[model samples]
Target: MNETIETLLNHRSIRKFTDKKLTDEQIHTIIKAAQQASTSSYMMAYTIIGITDPDKKAALAEVSGHPHVTQNGHLLIFCADLKRPVAQATSEQYEATRANLENSEHFLVAAIDAALAAQNAAIAAESMGLGMCYLGSIRNNLARTDEILELPKHVIPLFGMAIGTPDHQPELKPRLPISAVYAENEYPAYEEDVAAFDQELADYYESRSTNNRKDTWSEQMIRRFAKPMRMDVTELVQKKGFNKR
Candidate 1:
C-alpha cells in the first residue's frame, strides 16, 4: 500500500500525549494544511482559535471534562463562522445577507466546512508523527464554551482538537464492514452485516490493550442516542444566530 493509504488506515485517536510540544512551525504547517481543505463555494466559513493561556485552557478543560485539554502540547478550537462574511456585506446587502446566513443550510455548510478542515488538520498532524485527539465534549456545554472563548454572534465553536507527541500507542479500533457502509444503486438493508459487525466490535472492545469492556457497537450507539443528547444545542445554535430558518 502507498504511504498515504497506510496513514489513513492506521488512524487511531491518541488520548495520552507527551509533554513535548509542537513547534510554531509545525503549528503553522498544520493550520495551512487545514486551510487548503475544500470549501463550499469558496466560502471558507470557519475560524481556528488556538488556546495558549493556562487559565483559558483550564477553563476549556473544565467545559470539556477532559484533562487532556490542558495537558496537550497544543489546543485548537475550530469554529463555524459566518460573522466575517456578514461584516463585509454592503449596507444595502446587509439585511438580505443576514437573513440568508440565518438559514439552516448555511449553518450546515459552516459545520461541514469546519469538519472537513479538522480532518485535514488531523491527517497533517498524524503524517508529521504527532498524536491528536478531537474534543467533541467541548460541545457538551456550548454556552459556557462560547463564554470562555468570547465568541460573537454568527460564530459557533464546533469542536476542539488536542495535539502533541505520543505518550501511549492505542490499538486501532475496528470499523463497520464495507458491505454495510457502501452501496451501488440504492441503500441496501444490512441487518446481517450489522449483526456480524457487532460481534467483531465486541471482540475488539474485549481484547484491546487498555480499558477493555464487554460491549458491542450497537449497544454503544443505543446508549449514545437512546436519550436526548446535548438538548441545549438547538437553543444555543439559535443564540449564535444560526438555524433560524
Candidate 2:
C-alpha cells in the first residue's frame, strides 16, 4: 500500500505519550493541514484552542473526566464557532435574523466544519509519526469547559486532541467485515455479520494489554444505550444560541 493509505489503515489511538514534546514548527504544520480541510460553504466555522499551561491543562483534565488530558503532549480544544461570523457581520452593519442565527442548519454546519478540521489534524499528526488521541470526554461538563475556556456565546467546545511522541504500542483493533458496512442496491443484512464480529471483538478485548475485559462490542454498546447519555447536549446547544429551531 501507498504511504498515505498505510498510515490511514494503521491508525490507533495513543493513550501514553513520551516526555518529548512537539516543536512549534510541528504544531504549526499540523494546524496548517487542518486549515486546509474543506469547510461547508467556506464558512470555516471552527476555532482551535491550544493549551500549554500545566495548571490549565490539569483543570481541563479534571473537567473532561479524562486524566490523559494533562498528559505529556500538546492539548487542543476544537470549538464549533459561529460567533466569529456574527461578529464580522455586526462590524459590517449586517443584521442576522433570529432564524439565520439559531437554526439547526447553522449548528450542524459549524459542527461538521469543526469535525472535519480535527480529523485532518489527526491524520496529519499520524502521518508525521506522532501519537494522538481524540478526547470526546471533554464534553462531559460542557458548561465548565466553556467557563474554563472563556468561550463567548455561539461557540461550543466540540472535542479535544492530545498529540505527542508514543510511549506505548498497542495492537490494531479489529473492524467489522465489509459485508456489514458496504451494501449495493439494498442495505445488506448486518445482524449475522455483527454477531460474527462480536466474537472477534470479545477476544481482542480479553487479550488487550490495558484494561482487558471479557466483553464484546455489542455488550458494551448495550450497556451504553441502557441509559440516556449526554442528554443535556440539546440544552447546551440552545444556550450557545443555536438549535433553537
Candidate 3:
C-alpha cells in the first residue's frame, strides 16, 4: 500500500490524549486539507467551529454525554451550512428562497459535504501522527447543541471531532469482509458473508485488550435497532429550517 492507503487502513479512534497543543501552522495545514475535499456542485456547504472556550467545551461535553469532549487538545464541530451561499445568492439578486434552502436534496448535500471534509481532516491528522476521534454522539441533544452554538437558520451541527497527541494507541476495529460490502456489476447476496463476519467480530470482541466482550457485530446491531434512536432529529432539523421538503 502507498503511504496514503496505509494511513487510511491504520485508522483508530484515540480517546486518551497527552497535553500536547497543536501549533497554529499545524491547524492551518490540516484545515486546508479539509477544504480541499470534494464538494457536490462546488457549493462547499460546510462550516467548522473550533471550540476553544472552556465554558463552551464543558457545555458541549454535557450535551454529548461524553466527558472526553472537553479533554481534547482541539475540538471542532463540523456543520452543514447552507446559510452562507443562500445569503450571498440573495444579496446578488439570485432567486434564493426558503423553499430552495429547505429542500431535502440540499440538506443531504450539505450533510455529505460536512462529512467528507471531516473525513479528510481525520486522515490528514492521522497522517501527521496526531490522534483523533469523531464525536457523533454530539447529536444526542441537537437542539441543546444548536442553542449552545447559537446556530442560525439553514445551519446544522452534523458532528464534532476531537484531535490531540495520543496517550493511548487503540487496536484497529475489524470490519466486514470485502465480499459483504463490495459488488461487481450486480449486487450479490451478502448474508453469508455477514454471518462469517459476525463470527470474526465476536472473536475480536472477546479477545480485545480493552472492553473485551462476547457480543458479535450482528447482536450489537440488533440491540441498536431494537429501539429508535434520535427520534427528535427530524423535528430539530426542521426547526433549523432545512429538510422541510
Candidate 4:
C-alpha cells in the first residue's frame, strides 16, 4: 500500500498528550496544510480558532465534559462559518437575503470545508510526530462555544482538535467489516449482519474501556439509539439563524 493509505490505516485518536509545546513553525505548517485542503466551490466558509489561554481552555473543557481539553497543549476549533460570506456579500452591496444566507446546501458546504481542513491538519500533525485527537464534543456546548469564540450569525462551531506530544499510546480500535460497510453492487440488506458486527464491537470496547467486562455491541447500539443528539439540534441551530426545514 501507499504511504498515505498506511497513515490512514494506522490512525488512532491520541487522548493523552505530553507537556511539550508545539514550535511556532510546526503550528504554521499544520495550519497551512489545513488551508491546502479543497474547499467546496472555493467558498472556504470555515474558520479555525487556536485556543491557548488556560482559563478559556478550562472553561471549554467544562463545556465538553472532556478533561483532555484542559490538559492538552493546544486546542484547534474548526467552525462552519457562513457569516463570513454573508459579510462579504453585504460589503460588496449584494443581496444578503435570509434565504440566501441560510440553506441546507450552504450549511453542508461549510461543514464539508471544515471537516476537510481538519483532516488535513490532523495528517500534517501526525507527519510531525505529534499527537492529536478530534473533539466533536465542542458542539455539546454550541451556544457557549459561539459566545466564547465570539462567532457571528451564520457561524457555528462544529468541533475542536486537541494537539501536542504523546504521553501515552492508545491501542488501535477495531472497525466494522467491509461486508457491514461496503456493498458489492447496490446496497445489500444487512440488518442481520449488524448483530455479529456489534458482538465484535462490544468485545472490542469491553477490552478497551473496562477491564474485561462482558459488554456487547448490541448494548452499545441500544444505549446510543435510545438517546439521539439531533432531535435538539434544530432548536440550537435556530438560535444562530439556520432554521432547517
Best by lDDT: 1
Per-model TM-score versus the true fold: 0.97, 0.94, 0.96, 0.90
Worst 10 residues of 1 by lDDT: 85-94
Question: Residues 99-141, candidate 3, lDDT per residue (tens digit)?
Answer: 6788999999999999999999999899999999999898998
lDDT, candidate 4, 1-245, per-residue tens: 98777778788898888778888898899999999999987888899999988878877898898877877768899988877765756544544356755677777888899999999999998877888999988778677777888887778888999998888878887776777788988886667778778788777766775355766677767888999774655666767866463
TM-score of model number 2: 0.94
TM-score of 3: 0.96
What tens digits encode model 1's per-residue C-alpha lDDT throughout 145-176? Answer: 99999999999999999999988888887887
Candidate 1 ranges with C-alpha deviation above 4 Å: none
User: How does residue 203 of candidate 1 score in lDDT?
Assistant: 88
Residues 1-245, model 2: lDDT tens digits: 89999999999999889878889999999999999999998889999999998888988999777766887569989999987876756544544455766899998999999999999999999999998999988888888788889888889899999999989888887989899999999998999999989998988888888889899889889999998877877888899888899
**Which model is ahead, 1 or 3, in terms of lDDT?**
1
CA shift of 75, model 2, Å: 0.3
lDDT-superior candidate, 2 or 3: 3
Q: Top TM-score: which candidate number?
A: 1
Better of 3 and 4 by TM-score: 3
lDDT of every model, 2 decimals: 0.92, 0.88, 0.90, 0.81
Candidate 2 Cα outliers beyond 4 Å, as residue runs: 91-97
